[model samples]
Target: MHQHDRKIRTIGLADVSEPGDEALITPEVSAALATATDIVGYAPYVTRVQPRDGLTLHPSDNRVELQRAGEALRLAAEGRHVVVVSSGDPGVFAMASAVFEALEDAPQWQDLSIRVLPGVTAMLAAAASAGAPLGHDFCAINLSDNLKPWPLIEKRLRLAAEADFAIAMYNPRSASRPDGFARTLEILKEAGCGERIVIFARAVSTPDQRIETVELRDARPDMADMRTLVIVGNSATRRVGRWVYAPRQVR
Candidate 1:
């Protein structure tokens, strides 16, 4: 039989995981790490995995998801156990789609087994830290326009505001995209959300974690960055004593 004819036994697995304290790492993730022959992820996330003699770690720079996914697929095709890691949920603006996209171009690998392990995503953690600001209807938007156009993001922001859904925005601000979040704040205020609450959860679940709450009117663009998770409450979100929450029933 030729080299390609052998039926592969091992598979590639993708997990949504953040670089954080060991205590925050889920047990299932730990187990997957133990069995993985190769771990591929962004540099910081790959660094988080404790190095073992048998495990090979492939770390790459940001914005190289397709290449990373292809590498993982290749390793798995060789019958090596692989784990493609991502911060937060892989399905939420992360590596899951990239892997599938890579697989589409390489039809021979389609039969290879793949599993996705869920992690505690940032939006869920951010909402919890802010006392359930997402308890009611909410929508998450990635404010980074790297892949999509700015006009699309703007349109979605308008629709979200009109629907009065709590907005959880990822990649709200970055050095290269300084003005995007500023425009986002302006749009919300223009939509009459000045009285609504906004929560900024930065480096959530890590030692550098910081969470801040303020009114939408008072939210400044400088308060957010790549590490921050920005959550804007709906029209009816309110504060009870010291906690900010979205009431279960929307009026």
Candidate 2:
């Protein structure tokens, strides 16, 4: 393991709800972190998933946070193995983009050995547990207006509803983001039929996990939070007891 010491390793995003939830980290990522001593990951909770705590690397002038991430990148570039970690899938709305963006701004890190590992995104894990709600064409949209505007997100929702595609919604709700959920439901209702299925997956892969199915008209905003992953089914979606399935191979 020490032979790989000088390499720069980025651990995949993982849900930290519990040891069981750690399955969000893929096998390749597990191997990458096996020998890493210095690991930086997105804080487990949505409340802590910000740029201040090294959980994510993003455009910020916060002196303290910038200094810390700069040092980490510097160390890795200087031949010290450092891990940049994220929660859920880094490729999704996670830290990979931030890390690379920061590195791009600092050309000194261009020469460093950079590797991004893959992890199970919360939506996938949640969908798996609730049968296969994403067995067909699906779209993922983040409702956070921090980087992108609410109008753009709403437009995307309208398009998804119009296509009648299975949808995976991220950052559905947060303390600061109260209206995105309601707006999403309204748009979906306008574009799609009331018979559409909606699946709410909260605290996925953790002991406190909850999954439920509701009609498009009945989906509520109150039950959602940052940790929740919502899956909206097309007209063909069906629910049977605790399971929701989308027919893939209809003969």
Against the true structure, candidate 1 reaches a TM-score of: 0.91
Give one clash count per candidate, in the order shown.
Answer: 0, 1
Scored by lDDT, the top model is 1
TM-scores of the candidates are: 0.91, 0.84
Best by TM-score: 1
lDDT of each: 0.81, 0.71
Root-mean-square deviation of every model? 3.5, 5.2
The stretch of ten residues in a row with the least summed lDDT in candidate 1 is: 7-16
Candidate 1: tens digits of C-alpha lDDT, residues 41-140:
8888887778998999999999999998988889888878887877766678888889899989999989887777676677887787778898999999
Candidate 1, residue 173: lDDT:
91
